[model samples]
Every structure is written in structure tokens, then in C-alpha cells.
Target: MSLSPLPLGGAAPSATRTPSRSAALALVFGAFVLAGCATEPPPPPAPAIPQYTSPIPASALVGRYGLAAYHRPQDATRTETQARAQCSNPYVITDGPNGGVMMYLADDTKLTEVISKQVPGQPTYIGPAEDPAGGERDRQVISFNGTVLQLKWVDPEIAKRYGIMVYVRCP
Candidate 1:
């Protein structure tokens, strides 16, 4: 395109003076931020502890016990909803470094399809430790005498089948 003549000895404005995209976006963003500043929402309030906890029970290891809950995938689809809900095992105390008792929580519990019947070296089809239980495989007891709680996974194949883990503890 042909350029227009200069006016009163002033040089002709260059066509290269077009604004950059980032400059345009910054201008628009600044206007938007200024508009939002006029109507900013108030900050959230502090969390309120319940007053019903009048007298707190004192335990040397209450906080030490990790909170355990089912961590299976949420039933979102029709197929997953039809499947059984996995169970989560609670915390247990075991000897840690320096002979201290370390509380551990087990969360992941999933049902995997049984593929093989027997291994090369194994004799039996599968032992109690590797077998899924009969009727829950449920039957258990938790004995806590205000201090130490003995939790033994009693039901046959409960630990083996469900894959009870103890890696992650409660926050």
C-alpha cells in the first residue's frame, strides 16, 4: 500500500504501531481486575470446635491411633455401583525404631479377580493366607483396655483377599 504524505513536516505514522496481543490482554485484564476489586467477597471464618466436648478424655495414645477409613473408588458408574464396597481396617500398634510403638492405618481394600489355580512350587491350591474367606471371611474382635488394643485379623483369608495395607496413616 502507498503511504500518505506527511502533514506540516511531521513524519507519517507507521502502520507497524499496532498493539501487541499481550498488551491488549493486559489492558482488558486490568479493567476486569479493577471491576472485581469493588465487590470482593469477605474472607472465610475460623473453624469452631464443638462446645459439647466439655471434658476431654485424656489418653496417652488417643492421638497416636491413626484414623482409618475405606479409601476405595467412589461408586460413580452403574457397573462400579453394582460391585461390593471394599472394607478398611483400623490402626494397630507395632514396634518401631528405638522400640517405640508406631500406629499404622490400612486403607486400600479392593477385589481382584482370581486368575491362577496354583503356582509352580506351591503344593496346595492356596493356603489360608492367600485364600478369600468364607462368609465375610468376617469374625473379629477389638479389645481395648483404656490403653492397648489387640486387633487380630481373625476371619480366614481376610487379610490375603482384601489386601489390607498399613502404609498411610491419618492426618
Candidate 2:
């Protein structure tokens, strides 16, 4: 009794049951690739800087105040009017070196005054002057005395020109 020679190149009969090793390897690689793609989101950005404005203190006024508050004994009335007129013309006030006052106005009206030392840092406009120079010359400089609001000027000329002292209560 002789068995027939097994066919070396023909298709095998349909009962194959072995698992594929390459297919298992591909499944694991796909899972690892998917896991690597997952990630956490980043954090948000920071906030903006604050803007501060100067406010007037009512206690600093001496007597009945006028349009442009008095800066000195001499800067009583006339300078007050000029300052008020300057203010009416949309003027801007700035600081100068050696604690001076720099005033800017439209149509070529500029004035500079030197007096005491100005408070450090940028100045903020409070509002109209309460003494002589009407609504026009109504400007003040920002300052602090241990957290207390103080108006300051360095220019004596500015004080005289504006009809008020270099420093005063904001109002």
C-alpha cells in the first residue's frame, strides 16, 4: 500500500487554521501610532496694563477758589486770565528738565516756567483749574505724597504764568 506523493505546488485543501504573526505586529503598531497622536492643549495668555487718572482733593483749597487757582501771592488775577485763555484754546501741559513747566497750545501759544522739582513719572490731566485761569487753563500735574494725591509743578514761571503756585490741590 503506497501513499500518493503530496503535491508540492498545488493549493492546499480549505482547512487552514494558523494565525498570522505579521497581522498581530501591524495591529500593535497601529495602536501605538494612534496613542502618540493624542496630546493636551496649552495655557492661555496674560492680561493688559491699567490706566490711572488723577483726582482732586477738596481739603486743599484755601479761600473761595476761582477759574485758575492761585499758584502764588503774585500770580493773583492777570496771569490767571492768560492761563484760562490758553486752556480754552486746547492746550497741553508737560514737564521739563530741572522741574520746569511746559505748556503747549494751538496756533502758536507755548509757555515754559521753572520752579520746584516735579514729581517723577508721567503726568495725568485731572480737569479744569478751580481758581483763576478759567476752563481754558484748567490743567494739573499728577503726584503722590505717600499715596496721597498731590498736584505739582517745578517751574516758577509756570506758576506765575498760570496765576497759581507750582503745586496745589488737584481741584
- TM of each candidate vs. truth: 0.20, 0.20
**TM-score of model 1 (CA atoms):** 0.20
Pick by lDDT: which candidate is best?
2
User: Once superposed on the true structure, which residue ranges of model 2 sit more than 4 Å away at CA?
Assistant: 1-54, 57-72, 93-151, 154-171
| Least well predicted 10-residue stretch by lDDT in candidate 2 | 57-66
lDDT string, candidate 1, 1-171, tens digits: 987778443656776675667889999999999999989798898655222211112222233333222223341232222221221443433433332233322232632221111233322111122243212322122233443322334344555444322122223
lDDT of 1 at 108: 26
Q: What lDDT score is found at residue 66 in candidate 1?
A: 31
Q: What is the model-wide C-alpha lDDT for candidate 1?
A: 0.34
- For model 2, residues 1-171, the per-residue Cα lDDT tens digits are 976665444535447744457878999999988887885546665444222332323222221212344555575445445434443333233454433334332123555332222123644443322222212333444343422233433344454554332221222
